[model samples]
Target: MNLGIVGQAVGLFAVTNIDDVVVLALFFAQGAGRRHAARNITVGQYVGFAAIVAVAVTAAFGATFLPERVVPYLGLLPLAIGVRAAVRVWRHRGRGGQEEDERTGPGGPRLLEVAAVTFANGGDNIGVYVPVFATAGIVGMSSYVVVFLALLALWIAAGRYFATRPVVARALSRWGHLLLPMVLIGIGVVILVDGGAFGL
Candidate 1:
């Protein structure tokens, strides 16, 4: 059961998107003052994710009702988020350095700011979670939470390590933005198919 749950969670995570990872990594690499900020972002993300999962599970168990068409609508969410993130990246291409500096100032990280940004970043994940829970049920919540937390920790650690490596960070930044939208599109497609939208 645990293995099944972990596998499903991993699949969900993989399909939801990785743009947040790239953004968090860049944020972490850009400055020292934002370490706490990154932590706050992670906290906010998990909180948001957990809330989404809870609601989804409740709906799955029939404790709360959701419209049958919700899954199809949810499928489009990831695509939208991906597009928005891609646009942000394109807009920041020339001014990436300026943007980083502004986000990570000399003053300690802003908790609310981090939370807000993180919440926004997790939007795609929320949409994906709804369909996942509606179909898979809550049998995997514990394992799903554990796996997500572990991945979050890994992402944070990787961000800290990459922040100190300017060359690697620069190289990653070049293509990272382009990948965000593609990842989200791919995930959205998968979810849509899973929901039988494509007759799968």
Candidate 2:
């Protein structure tokens, strides 16, 4: 458990997941301003991140081979999600349908919904993590995972803080429909370009 591994993990996670703060803020804004909502979001993020880590660790161990070429394609998951959100807002004028109502109501967010969004948001994370984990032996990987999980809590807290800020929350609530989709699509394009996935 080298301290260097821990530091690297923290830096890697923070850099790779900076956008997650915005995404989490959006999800938290959808909350009913209740603790349960925040709790669910936290749990969902954990579940999604755990899934990514599992796959990444497997790939690291040679149990799987998710080629670097596949990294950019993962962007499609978030792109589709963003398109759906945009369409929903357009059709309903931001008033949302029954499904939207359910999302914002007292019952709070469903675990699966949060998990799916979290997983989709982390599509790029897998690409960054696989190589890091592969390079790090088990001891290094273990340290990295520990630091990442700890930082994950900070992400949830930061999201909650943003949600509580009236200015940020209002802005997100008012414009998230348009902003979220654009952000998602932008992320996808970045991945494709950065990875040169198209070899263009």
Q: How high is each candidate's TM-score? A: 0.54, 0.79
> Model 2, 1-200: lDDT tens per residue?
68777778889999988888987887777664444778888999899888888889998888866565776666666667667766766886745565455654464445766676677668668877888899888988988888989999999999889877889878876775567667766766665676676673
What lDDT would candidate 2 get against the real structure?
0.76
Against the unseen true structure, what C-alpha lDDT does each candidate score?
0.58, 0.76
**Stretches > 4 Å off in candidate 1:** 33-35, 58-109, 169-200
Which candidate number maximizes TM-score? Answer: 2
- Candidate 2 RMSD computed on C-alpha atoms after optimal superposition onto the true structure: 3.4
**Deviation of model 2 at 38, angstroms:** 2.8
Among all windows of 10 consecutive residues in model 2, the one with the lowest summed lDDT is 101-110
Score candidate 1 by TM-score against the native: 0.54
